[model samples]
Target: MMLTCIAVDDEPLALRLIANFIEQTPFLQLVGSYSSAAAALRGLQQQTTAVDVLFLDIQMPDLNGLELARVLDKGPGTDKPRVVFTTAFNQYALEGYKVDALDYLLKPFDYAEFRRVADKALAYANATRPTAAEPALLPQEDYLYLKVEYQLVRVDFRDILYIEGLKDYVKVYRQSEARPLLSLSSLKSLEERLPARQFMRIHRSFIIALNQVKSVSRSTVQIGSATIPVSDRHREAFDQFLSRWK
Candidate 1:
């Protein structure tokens, strides 16, 4: 598979060198090359598909490479571009891994070194890339993939307690877990994708599995230790659903 990529560096020469290297690589495709992080970000925002990899320079004006990496890491999509930091300094190497960068290329490096890391990134991209067929959402399907921290995590539908919306993100509460799975997706998007017969949105910000509901009060639904509010807008529908249980 051809891995689409972009390069960002403050140095014009560095950008040109990386672009040239990418062009020569058979499996790599150079989508864009920018002199600054902001320009690269703007260009990425305009693209319909996420670039497969990014060759980033850590020390850039306005917005440094590290900050740019963090922003792209939390991008609003399942396919987050893998980052390969290109810097002259060795100090930021540790910081690069913190953001889960695929590889690092120290400056003054040659085409051989670039090719080595490029090959590694390509392998990773191919391994993690989802299959062409979308996951079936059948009634018997017990699990689904949720994009969390640049990785797609498989979550069993039965393990889910409820989902809480937090602006552009969602906190997926599941059984036997203290912390929720935070994902870069809207609750509405997840609500629409979930099996409607098994799950219901009881509030604008909440969606609960029908089986997980323990009890229903005047305006709240109980599930284990959590008490999720049933908003007026959703109350009538929820009442209709609860009627079937009786």
Candidate 2:
């Protein structure tokens, strides 16, 4: 798939360089290029088509790239663009990952380095791309496979007590196991794959099995020994689900 992209840099040369690189890349299509993060934000808001990727420079005078990434990360829209931080400084690398940036391109980077991160961004975009086809609910399918340590581990849905999201990874708590299954994946992706009738996202960082919830105490849910918080965003839906149970 051809991924649409935008570049945001305070420097005219840097912005032009990224734009040129994007044009040279076969899979990437440069939709917009801006001299500031604010202008890029406005362009993103006003654009007709959803931007799939963002090539952002970390340092800027107004609305720095990191702050812009955070704003887009919490956006109400589900089709949030993937971020690739471009900066001369290496210190912002850790912070960029916190916002779930797909890659980081250091300043003075060669075309080869740019292409490598671009390829990674394209793969990520395609993997998380939404499809018109609805997922089938296979009731008899009790287990799901997760790639862990380069191996696919089978995890039974009935054994799952709750899921705790840790940035790009998730810890799946099980009934019988002492240690939770850790895997490299986003909570949103897993939530979409699981059967919605049996599982519900109670918080931005938690998803619990309806059958495993022992009790609900105000804004918290009790499942086994763990207490998961139900944020205000998800509380109303949880309350409605409880009402249906009654």
Candidate 3:
């Protein structure tokens, strides 16, 4: 079966790029493309049937990717389409998975990576129709890959100091480097998949490795100059995570 897909991005060029990529994939049927999350919502509402996949962009003007994903989640029943988050920014992956996206795509992604994610989405979509239960989402082993400018780089969890989400992107602050590396995975996705015994979500935008955390303040937690915020939602959990270290 073909995977029904849609592209939702604020930038016209971004939308075009995804559209072109989708067209090249044999199993993906470009069911719809929208320049805004609002338009995608309208299309979802007007169309009685469900879509197989969504290539959702996170940084739209009014209705951002996260909001759109949340809206799509409340379907008529449990059976619904898969989501593939597409964004230039990397921090939203954690938030993206909370809505259960099939995969995350960074901007300027090559065709090979596109096919990899598209195939996973196809499998997830097809899995729904089988006799067995929905497959348990698995976590990655060894390391995670990130798209940086023109190259694909591997980042081991041990090297990270903290991660901060910006719009659709994530800034991975490292222990050895002065600069933070940007990646396509969201803070939410990282929070879920990353070994929680090692990492802590201290804020909505920040996730820090428990061993890497040097000190804590009323407003922030520090790892070098990378001061991660402590938000109300994460405060209690972070406190508990820290207590284990104490």
* Candidate 2 vs candidate 3, lDDT winner: 2
My TM-score estimates for the predictions, one after another, are 0.64, 0.65, 0.53
Off by over 4 Å in 3: 131-246
Residue-level lDDT tens digits of model 2 in 15-64: 89999999999999999999999999999999999899999998899799
Worst 10 residues of 3 by lDDT: 131-140
- Taking every candidate in turn, the Cα RMSD to the unseen true structure, in Å, is 5.8, 6.6, 9.2
Q: If the candidates were sorted by their TM-score against the true structure, best first, what order would they fall in?
A: 2, 1, 3
Error of 3 at 142 (Å): 30
Which residue runs does candidate 1 get wrong by more than 4 Å? 12-27, 36-50, 58-142
> Could you give candidate 3's per-residue lDDT for residues 108-191 as a string of tens digits?
788899999988776555533443453333343445555554234667788988888987678988876789997655678667
